[model samples]
Target: RFDMAGVGDSELVEGGLLYVERTRADVVASMDALSERVDSRRFLLMGLCTGAYNAFRAALIDDRVVGCILLDGYSYPSIRSQIEHYRKRVFQLKRWVDFTKRKLGIDTPSGSAVQGDLVVFENEVVSKERFAGELQSLIDRNVRLLLVYTGLGPLSFTYRRQLHDAFPKIALDDVATVHFYPAADHTFTLPGHRQRLLDDLDTWLADEFESETAARG
Candidate 1:
């Protein structure tokens, strides 16, 4: 995958901003460039963080995108998600110790509480209703969707079931595959974590693409 404009080796415009629209445009441009060189029409968009968001959005609009692998992508927490997050934190001894220290004026509160309000992304947030609709559209088109979560932060995805729980109405099991690697950090800095990430990707790609090929034949 190529880097977005103003990032990595790509030339950055003086006042360029990587907003949603611009990011989508860049993805389209990249696809167009690829088309000129490759004979294949099918494409699978894969990315992490904002890149993942872009890939999802791109796949929704572009019929050529047969699949997408989203890593730490859009996560909208539900009321239950918020409750579950704090419920887990409540059991942590460090949390109690910190609370007691603050109560006794021995230490100041560091604002590290696991809360939903803290789960904000820099770009505009898509409504759950709209996301659900988009997700359905992709499923109807038979796009292979893979969502992978890492141990970046619990605020966005506190648990393995958070995605399914947030969109209870949507039948995600029928449309998407999800994996959670809570022990691995966001970037997968450690060698073992990186290997785990790669292994997961290899398996997903083989299974998804092989199934698609068999279906076409």
Candidate 2:
């Protein structure tokens, strides 16, 4: 699976994961380019974190995507809400840095312990950036997709409700299952959890593929 632009190894020239809108646009571009070469009708899209949001959005726009698997991500909300949340953490970090400089009379980094909390909160806001109007759009297209969100993170409750309301065919229990994870972190990179999650995914995917194959036969 290829990583989209401005992510992982594909960092932007400006540096840092600051511009989320640009990243979403890049994902869209990549999807459009990829669709040209393959049969859109058969392609299956899967992603983790922000990539999950991208895959869902791509499926909504391009009819070629037959299925999607999303892991540990938020649903669509206004970019404004995301931006405001992001700014709060950034300002906090900046305050800590400035306070240290003023008190110490020199520029020095704050204690690691304090920095850690800031990082967690920062991640919360960062996840929201990729959550554009994609989930709602996906339901509108009647896309067959599985969205996995953790019970442990800072997800928008409103958005989750919106997802359930949008897809009446998808019951609340199914939606609860879709956002499965032992922990509420972004990726659930914890030990053993990854494998367990993957195993569940493998079973679900096998079922889907088998059903498709049977229909074709």
Candidate 3:
């Protein structure tokens, strides 16, 4: 429930948004504080949006993190995703209207598929190759990863199989689980959506803990 520096109750710092190194340091500091107070050795990192990205980054470096729950973390559209996006758009009424207008030289599309506000970090981009490598490293360390995606715009993840497509070299079955909720918004604003998310989390956590216990014995 802790907020990163410059967010929520924490004091703002200079150059906070430009670099992720500070965020990662904050996560480690929080984990250290928790360890001093609790007897538990296992830790689970769960976050949404930017929080998700930080959690994932922390998990990669910290072996103490047993599991991670990421909600719409970091995703980039692969070539296949791009093709699928435009393919679906081709059938939509609005797309055709826009296309016709462009053909008639009446109107033109303004920008790329990716939105400007969606860009959170500056000068730090995680390539798909590096991401896959990090994912594999986490898997090798026996870290459990749960990726959850919502129906928010700029659909980087429209299908369950996109993860596999993005990291074709990695064997995800042994370590990763993915869930998609195409009807819900990014924040799960609706009561039903929230309930569904809770239920799913509960089920997954129970299963994950059981497996961890079995592995220990």
TM-scores, each model vs. reference:
0.82, 0.53, 0.84
* Candidate 3 C-alpha lDDT tens digits along 1-217: 9988888899866764555788888888888998889855678999987788899999988889989998888776766877977787778797677778878988565746323424443236778888888888999998888888886633456777678777777898788788888887878889998898899888888877887678888
Query: In lDDT terms, how accurate is model 2?
Result: 0.58
lDDT comparing candidate 3 with the true structure: 0.79
> Cα deviation of 84 in candidate 3 (Å)?
2.6
Model 3 misplaced stretches (Cα beyond 4 Å) = 13-18, 76-80, 107-109, 112-123, 211-217
Per-model lDDT: 0.80, 0.58, 0.79
The model with the greatest TM-score is 3
Tens-place lDDT digits, model 2, residues 95-156: 67767786889855557744553333222352422433444455455556666766455454
Per-residue accuracy of model 1 over 1-217 as CA lDDT, tens digit each? 6888789988755455557767888888888888889856889999887778899989988899988988888777778768976787879897688678878888654575434347554477788898889988998898988888875643357667788988888888876888887777766778998888789889888887887688888
Whole-model alpha-carbon lDDT for candidate 1: 0.80
